[model samples]
Target: MSSIIKLCSSLSSRYNPRLIVSRFTVQPRLCSSVKPSSGPSSSSDHDLKASHKVDNFERKILVWTGKYKSVDEVPKMVSQDTMERARNRMRIKIANYMMAATVVGCLIMVYSGKKAAERGESVSKQNLDWHKSYQAKADKTEKDYASKFEHMAREGAEAAKAN
Candidate 1:
């Protein structure tokens, strides 16, 4: 009978341990050290001092780089070969684009001139005479620009060699 009564008491306590734990464990209170300040002046002053130190450190690093940090930090100028390759690529791209544009413009002009001629519209005392005139002018302009560019390139090469 005594063993049976002990078994019953143990079963009852196992099912309700929360009351036992709460009665024995102590709850913790908040600490005073981490509480927020009641005023703004101290906080602002602290922030300003932090920012000033950061600025001073940045200036020191800049001065340490060289007399003028910007001038010293700049990478050396590109090599002439690299520049020449870039220039050549750019010129080729420009030439290709200009050629494409010129072809497109000529096609458009020819198509329009043909349409006007079909409609019996007289331009410059002859039907679609303006087209021929503009074609001649365009041919001359292209030749002139080509010769000028070639001359400039030759002169530039000579000047570079002399230098």
Candidate 2:
């Protein structure tokens, strides 16, 4: 029963996510003092040896795989070739868009011109009718004024003769 309990406990620990994560995580040591197993001199010497070993281990583990110390030390993610390709693609896209816009503008202008042409004939006919009416009224007014002037001149001539 004791062996079974131990096996179960070990299996639980192995399957536990938190225990697995904590086992792999490196915890920082606050101090490098080794607990004295013997005399003070021996303990001091042991502490120094242990600290040196820890430093070497840390230095080995902290080595950069890419020879980069930080993000700033890393090379640019985008290559010049890729940037140039993207620039060319963007230029092509802009050219296509400009061509499409020009076509649409031309189509709009053509449609408006057709509509204007359809309306122009009716507008010109209405203008001709208006001008004819105006001219007829002007001619009648001028004849009326001329007859009034002729009657006044005849009256003045008769008055001069009588005098």
Candidate 3:
């Protein structure tokens, strides 16, 4: 029993999770004895070098979370040329959208005009058929009235000749 307990304790100590994790984790180091840089140029140069070292992956991991030791280590979020190109792309996309919309609107207008013309032609044909029927009725009524007047005139002339 004693030997077994000793073996367990040794194994636990050797495989301590905290110690294993700490060995792999990189801890931030504090510089207490180092003096500040003497000149502004030297400090600025150090900052420039640090900033240049911050690539996409470093910037993503270190800068946003404030994990960097100094503010100078953070790089610019985006370059000027990249920003300009993005703006130009946006403008071009908007122009393309507007052009497509204009073309669709013109197509719809043309289709509507064609439909309206077709409807107008049908309506005109119906109106012409109705006018022709009305004109035939009017001509028949006129002929009936003229024949009645001529019969009355013949009767009067025959009566005058007999008297």
Please report the candidate that would top lDDT against the real structure.
Answer: 3
lDDT of each: 0.59, 0.59, 0.63
Better of 1 and 2 by TM-score: 1
* TM-score versus the correct structure, for each prediction: 0.31, 0.29, 0.29
For each predicted model, how many residue pairs clash, with residues at least 3 apart or on different chains?
0, 0, 0
* Per-prediction CA RMSD (Å): 25.1, 28.8, 22.8
lDDT, residue 125, candidate 2: 82
Model 3 CA deviation exceeding 4 Å by range? 1-76, 121-163
What is candidate 2's lDDT per residue for 1-163, written digit by digit as tens? Answer: 6775565466566754223233779444322234656555665654443332223322322223223354453333333443344456666766899999999999998898789888774567889999999999999999999999999999999999999
Q: Candidate 2, residue 56: CA error in Å?
A: 42
Summarize candidate 3's per-residue lDDT along 100-135 as a digit string, tens digits.
Answer: 999999999889879988777566787999999999
Show where candidate 2 strays beyond 4 Å.
1-76, 121-163
Q: Order of candidates by TM-score, top first? A: 1, 3, 2
Worst 10 residues of 3 by lDDT: 26-35
lDDT of 3: 0.63
Q: Tell how far residue 24 is off in model 3, in angstroms.
A: 71
For residues 64-118, could you state the per-residue lDDT of candidate 1 as single tens digits?
4332265344223333443344446666766899999999999999999999889
